[model samples]
Target chain A: MCFYIVINDILKGLKNQEHKYIAQAISIVENNSSLNKNLLLNLKTSSMESIKIGITGPPGAGKSSITNQLIKKYRFEDKSVCALLVDPSSPFTKGAVLGDRIRMRDFYNDSKVFIRSIASRGSKGGLAENIDYISDIVEFSGFDVIIYETVGVGQVELDVVDSVDTTIVVLVPESGDDIQVMKAGLIEIADIYVINKYDRKDSDKLFLTLTNMLQLADKDKWIPKIVKTVAINDIGIDSLKDELAIHRKHLIKSNKGLDKYNDRFIKKIKHRLISDFENSFWNKKRYEFLNSEIEKDINDRLDIDSIINKIKSI
Target chain B: MCFYIVINDILKGLKNQEHKYIAQAISIVENNSSLNKNLLLNLKTSSMESIKIGITGPPGAGKSSITNQLIKKYRFEDKSVCALLVDPSSPFTKGAVLGDRIRMRDFYNDSKVFIRSIASRGSKGGLAENIDYISDIVEFSGFDVIIYETVGVGQVELDVVDSVDTTIVVLVPESGDDIQVMKAGLIEIADIYVINKYDRKDSDKLFLTLTNMLQLADKDKWIPKIVKTVAINDIGIDSLKDELAIHRKHLIKSNKGLDKYNDRFIKKIKHRLISDFENSFWNKKRYEFLNSEIEKDINDRLDIDSIINKIKSI
Candidate 1:
C-alpha cells in the first residue's frame, strides 16, 4: 500500500511536468529498479505525441555541435526537448563525452531542455535496448521532441535507426572517401545527411559526391536529402531544419512513420517478454548447475548433449 | 545410422588433417546445422595445441598486410596457420576486404596455410560467438596456429580479445591523437602495440605517445610493448613475432592464459545454454501472442503485466 502511494506521488509529479520527477523516473529505469515496472506501467499514456530524432556519425563528425543547434531551434519554437547522449565506456571514446557535454552546456539553465548522458559500459545490448524505454519516459513527460545522439560504433547505429523516426547521419569534409560513405551503409539509414563543418576545405567536393550517390538510391522511397552546415558558425541550420520538416512529411505520407512506430512497438514487446522469460528461467539452481558442469572440464563436449536435453525438457 | 557413418568419416578425415573435412566441419558450424552438435562433440580433443593470435586495429592500419606477412613467416618455419579474417558488411569498410584479399593472395596456393573470410553480416553475436566453435574445429584439425583478424568495429575487438590468447592492437600514425587512443580503451587491451606504416612521417610521435601511456598503466601486470613496422615493406614483423612469443610466455607464467581459456569456456557454456533456452521458450504460440498483443495498442502499458504474468507462468 505504501509503495503504491509513493508511486502515485511520482506519477502525479510527472503529470505536472516536474523535472525532478522526470529525472527520478529515468533513474529508476536506468537502474532497473524493482519499482520500475510499476512506475512505468502506471504512468499515464502520452496524449501529446513526441518526435524522436537520432543523430549518429563516426567519431569527430561534429554530431554534438549539430545537436546543440537543433535543440536551440526546437526551443525557439517554444517546444520542450529531451536529449539523450549515449557515451560509450571505451576509453578511446570517453574523451568525446566530456567534449560533447561542454558544447551543449548552453541549455543547462533552460528549464524546457533536458539533457542526460547515458553510459554504455555495462549494457550488453549496446544502450539501444534501453533507449526505447527511456524515450517512452521522456515522451510521457510531455516533451515535444526527444533526441538520441550516439557515435557510430558497432551495432549502435543500426540499433538507433530501429528506434527513431528520423535519423540524421552527420559527416564532415574529411570523414572518408566517397566509397567509404557508401560502404558504411550510412546512405541507406539517413533520413537526412548533414555534412557538418562545411567551412572546411573540400566540403563542396563531398557535397557533390553525396548528391551523385544519393541520386542512384531507390526512387520508390523517400529520398534522403543532404544539407551542408558549419555547426560552430550555425550556418545552413535552417536548411537542415527545413529538410527535417520535409522528411517528417514524407514519413507520414508514405506511412513509414506508422511502420517505424509499429516496428518499435513489436520489438519492445518481444524484448520485454524475452527478458521476463530469461529472469524466470535462469534460476540460481540452473546457474549453479551450469557452473559445476563447466568446472568439471571445459574442453569436454560430452556434457553439451545433457545440457541441451535439460533445456529441451523445459 | 547413415548420419553416424558420415560423422565418423568426417572425424577420421579431421584427424588426418584433411582441409576438405575441416572446411565441411566449419561450414556445418557456420550454418548452425542440426548435425553441427554431433560432429563437434565427437571430434577428438586437440593433442597438438595451437597458438591463437588476434590482430586488430583501425580500418586503414595495415592489419591484413601484417597478417599476410605473419603467415609468410610462419609458413617459412613449416608450421601450418589458419587465418580467420572477419569482414564487416558495412559498405564503408567492404572495399578494404577486397583490398586485403588481393594483398593476401600469396597464401591461397599454400597447402599449409588456410585463409577463410567470415562475413559478419548476419551474426547477431558479432561473429565472436562462432569464432570459438570454429577455432576448436581448426585446432582439432592439427593446425599450428589460429589467427583472428578483425577491424576495430563495435564490440568485435573486445569479443576477439575474450577468445584469443594473444592480442595485438595495430595502429597507424594517422589513427588518432593520444586522447582518442586512450578513449577507445585500446591502451588497456593491447598485449602488444604495433605502429604499422612506421615509414610515414610522425610515426615516431605515435610510438612515443603509446610508450608514455603504457608507463601510466598498472605496473603489477605485464607492461604492454610497442613495436613499429612498415608492414608493406615487411619490416619489423620478426620483432613483432618475437614480442608475441614473449607475451605468450607472460600469459602462461602469470596464469592468465589458463584464465582466458577458462573464461571462454564459461562464456561458451553460458551463451549456449541461453540460446537453447531462447529457442525453447520463444515458441510459435508465444510469438503469435506477443505480435497480436502489440498490434492491438502499442502505447498501452496495461498489457505489459499480463505479458509478464504469462512469461512467469512458464
Candidate 2:
C-alpha cells in the first residue's frame, strides 16, 4: 500500500470517527514511520472545540483512579472522551508495565471512552517525539474531551501538562511532607489540586497546608482550588467535575482561552520542527562521525563549536 | 578585556587552586557566555583520577543530609570534595530557593569541602546545558570526590546519574508505596540504595521489599546493597561510605571502571555538541522567524518539515 492511500484511509476513518483507524494512525506516528511526516503535514488543525486536560502527580498518587473518575463523569454526560496515558519507560530496565490500564478496564468495553497508553520511549524528553501529533490526531478524531495522564511528577510530565489548557496535580496525603511539596515546586503548576485518598488521617492537615501555601504564594488570578476525593468509591467526583467546568468558564471569560490555544499551537510547531531537525541532522553518518571523533585524541580533532558551525554551513 | 586574556587568567588561577577562579570559570560557563566555547575547547579532560558520585531521589528524601554526611566523611580523610545540587527551577513561579545550601553551612567555612548549586533552568533536560563543563571545571580544580545531588527522581536526574561512575538512590520509608518505587523506575538506576530516616516503622519493610525487587530484577554482576541511615545524627554513615567503596572497588575489578570513564567522556562530548547545535541553531533570528510563521495560516505557509528542510539547506 502506498503511503498516500494509507493516510487517506486514516483520514477518512478519522472523519468517520472510526476507533480502529485512530489507533493505527497513532501507532504509525509513534513509531516515526516514513509516512509519519506526511501524516502530520496533511493534518489540519483540529476545528472541534475539545477540552484538553492534563493530569499529573507523583507515582501511586491515584492519578489513574482520578482519571477513571473523570472518564466516567464525562461518559455519563453522553460525551465522547479519549485518554492518553504517557508512560515513562526506563532506559536501563526496558520493561515498564502500564498497570494503570488495569484500573481503567471499565472503559475498555465502552466505545465512547477510548483509552490508549503511549510509552515515553525513554527519550531525553519525558514525552514521545510524536506526542503532539498524536494528541492532534486524537483531537481531530471527534472526541469532546482529551485527557492526558502522566505517571510521575517529572519534568517530562510537567512539559506535557504545560502544553495542555487545564492541568490538575493530584497528591495523596502520604505522598510527601508539605516542605517536600514546596521543594518539588508542585504548588505552582497546578490549576487545580486533588487530594486523593482523603480518608487518610493527615489529609485535612495536608489540605490546609496546601491552601495556606497557595495563599502565601500570591497567585495573581485563578487561585487553584483543592478538591478531596476518594476516587475508588467515586466520592467527590461531581465536585471535581464542577471545578473543571468553573476553570473552563474562567479561561473563556478571561481571554486566556484563545491565548492558551495559540500558545499550544506555537509550541506544537516548534517541537515538531526541532524533532524533524534532530531526525534529519543526526543520521547514521553523523553518529559514526561523532563516535569516531570521540574516540580520537581530543587535541587532534576540531572542537565541538567548529564542527557544529561546519555542519550548519554544509 | 579580551576573552583570551580572561580565560588565561582563570586557567592560571585554577592551576594555583584559587577557589575564586573556580567559581568564576563555573559562572562563565553556566551563563553560556561567548567565551565558553573557547574555554571548553582549550580545556583538556581531567588527568587526575577522581570519583564521581550521583545522589538522587524524590524531594525531601533527606538527600541534603546524606550529602552532608558524605562530604564530612571524605573531608575527614583529608580529601577535597565538591558537591553540586541540581535544582529544578519552576517554570511558572520562576523562584527556585537554594535552601540546600543553608544545610551545608558547616562546610561553607571549610576549605576542604566546596558546595555549588546548579539550576536546571527549566529546560527540557534536567541538568543545565553547561553542567558537563561545570563538572569538568570542578574536576580539574583538584577535587578528589565530586558528588551530584539532584532534588527529584526525574529523567533529568536520571541522565545526570547515568553520566557519573556511581549512583546512589536515596529513599525514605514515607517516600511512597512499593508500586510507586517501581513506577518511578528508581530501582534500576541505583548502584546503592539508602533508606534514610531508618527509625521509621516501615523502614525495615521497605528495605526488604527493595532487596527482593533487586533480586527479581536480575542485576547481572554487582548486586545493589541496601543501607539504612539516620543522616542527621550521622548514624550508619560509615556503613554507607563502606558500600560506596565496595561499589567503587567492584567497578574497578570488573574492568567497568575504564568503560564508565569512557562512557562519561563520550557523553560529555555528545552533550556539548548538542548544546552547541541548539545554541547556534536557535538564534534570535530563528526565534523571530518561527514565531512569525506560527502566526500564519497553516495552509498559507510552509509546513514545519519544509521549514526545517529549508533552514538546513540554507
Candidate 3:
C-alpha cells in the first residue's frame, strides 16, 4: 500500500478506536526522531475530549501504584485510559525497574486500556516533545484520559507541565526536607500533590508543610490540591479521582487549557525548526572545515564568530 | 573602559594567571546563552598545557572528598589546579549539599587552587557546551590541571566524555546491583573506576564484578583501570594520581585525545547553530502565528507540516 493509503486507514482506525492502528501510529512517532509532520497534521484535525494528566515523582514514591489506581477508577466509570511510562533511564534498559508493568498488569488484556513505555534515547528535550505528540495520538484513538507517569525529580518532571492539563506530583513522607522540595521546583509544577504512603511516619507533617508553603505563595491562581493516599491499598483513590475531575472542571472554567495548548505549539514549532536545521545544514565540506579548524595549532585556530559567519554564507 | 580594552585587559590578566580575570571570563560565558565568539577568538591564540579530568558518579559517593584529596596531591606538587563542580541540580539551590566546599576549605586561602560550581539553569546541552568553553578559559589562564566534578549518573556524565581526556567513575559499595551499573551505561564511560569506601561490605565484590564485566567487552581498546580507595583516610589517592598520569600517556600514544577533540568541535558547532537559530527565528510575528494556530478549534487547526512550511516561507 502507498503511504497515503496507510495513513488514511490509520486515521479511520483511530476514529473507530482500533487497537492495531493506535499501536502502529505510536510506533511511527516513537521510531522517528523528527516529528512526523504528515501524520501529526492528519491526527490534529480529528479531535477528542481526552484529558491529559501527568504523574511524576522521585523513584520509590509509588507513582506506578497511584497510576494503576487512577486507571482502575477511570475504567470503572467506563472511560478508556492510556498510560505512558516515560522512562528517563538509558534506552537499552527495560522498563521493569519502575514496577509500572506489574502494577498495571490487570489492564494488559483490556482492549479499552493501553500502556506503553518510552525511553529518553539520549535526547532530553525530544522525549518530552514526543510525549506531547504521542498523547495526541492516544487521544485521537478515542481514549478518554491519558496519564503520563514519569519517574525522577529533575527537568523531566518540569517538562511535563507544558503538555498536560493537570500535573500531579507524588511524594512520600520520606521524600525530603522543605529545601529539597523547593529546590526541585515541584511546587510550581504540581496541580495536585499526592502524599502516597500517607500512613507512614511524618506524613501529616509533610502534608501540613506543603499546605503552608502553598498558602504563602500567590493565592490568586489555582492553589494546588493535596491528597493523601496509601496507593498499594487503593486508599483515597476515589478522592484522587474527584480532585482530578475538579481540576479538569477548573481548567475549562478558567480557560487554562488554551494556554497549555499554546505553549505546546510554540515548543513543538521551535523543536521542529531546530531539527530541520540540524538535518539540512551540515555537509561534508562544512565538517572538513570544522576538522581542519580544530586541527590548527591552538595559537593559530580561527575565531568561532568568523567560522559561524562563514558557515552561514556557505 | 570600553568593551575591547576591557576584554584585552582580561586576556592579559588571564595570561598572568590572575584570578579576577578567570572569574570574569567564566561569568561572561555563564551569563550569555550564546557563544561569545570574540572572547573565544581572543582565547584561541593563547596556549597552555592543561590536563582536563572529569570525575562523575552518583550522589553520596564521596566524590568531593576524593576531589579534595586530588587537589591536595596536586598542590603538594606545586601545580596550579582549577576545579569546576558541575552541579546538575536546580540552579536555585546552593551547592552546599555536595560538600565540595567543606572538604576543600583548606584550599580556599590557597591561590594555587581555584574552585567554582556550575548549575544547569534549565539548559541540558548548553551546560556541557559551556563546560567546554570554560575549560578553555581555565586552560588559557596557566592552570596546569582542570578537573570537572559532576554529580550524576546520566546524560551529563556521558557528555563529559566529549570534553575531557580522562573520565573517572566513582562508586560506593552500596551503589546498586550489577544491572544498575550496566543500565547507567557506566561500564562504557569509565576510563577509571574508583570503588570508594573500600572498607565497606561488597566493595571487593563490586571491584571484581566490574573487572570481569570490562574483560568481556572489546579488548582492542585500553581496558578501563579499576582502583579502591578509602577517601576519608586519603588511602590510595597517590595510586589514583598515578593511574591518571598513565592514562595521559596512553592517550598521547594512542591518539584518542584527537578523537575527543574532534567530537567536541562537532557538538560545539551544532549547539552554536541551534542557539543561533532559536535567537534569530523567534519574533513577535512568529509567536502570534503560533498563538492563532493553536487557538483554532481542534478539528479546524492547521496541520503542523503546513504551518512549519508557511513559517519557513515567511
Quote the positional error of residue A180 for candidate 2 in Å.
1.7
lDDT of 2 by residue, A1-314 (tens): 68678788888898777889989988887666745645554466542268888998876678888888899889988999999877656642233344666667888788888888776652334363566677778877878898998765556666676557789988888754655676665766788999999998889888988877777656578899999999999988899989988998888888677677566666665566555556676767667776676676546657656655554454
lDDT of 1 by residue, A1-314 (tens): 98778777777777677888878877776676745644584344432267778898765677778889999999999999888887656544455567666777898789888888776544444355576667667777888888888765445556677767899999888754654454344666788999998888988888898888777767887778889899888998999989888887777787777778777765666566556556676777777666665566546644556765664454
Better of 1 and 2 by DockQ: 2
Instruction: Give the CA lDDT, 0 to 100, for residue B276 in model 1.
Output: 62
Across all candidates, the chain A TM-score values are 0.91, 0.89, 0.91
Ranking by DockQ: 2, 1, 3
Best by TM-score: 2
What's the count of clashing pairs in each model shown? 13, 0, 0
Best by DockQ: 2
Give the per-residue lDDT digits (tens) of candidate 2, residues B1-314.
68778788888887666788888887777666745545654455532267888998876678888999999999989999888877655642233344566678888788777787776653344353466677677777777898998766555676677657789998888754666677666776789999999998899888887877777756576778999999999999999999999988888788687677566665665555555566667777777776676577545657556665665554
What are the per-model DockQ values?
0.32, 0.39, 0.27
Q: In angstroms, how far off is B178's CA in candidate 2?
A: 3.9
| Model 3: DockQ score | 0.27
Could you tell me the TM-score of chain A in candidate 3?
A: 0.91
Kindly provide the TM-score of model 1 when superposed on the true structure, using C-alpha atoms: 0.86
lDDT of 3: 0.73
Docking class of 1: acceptable
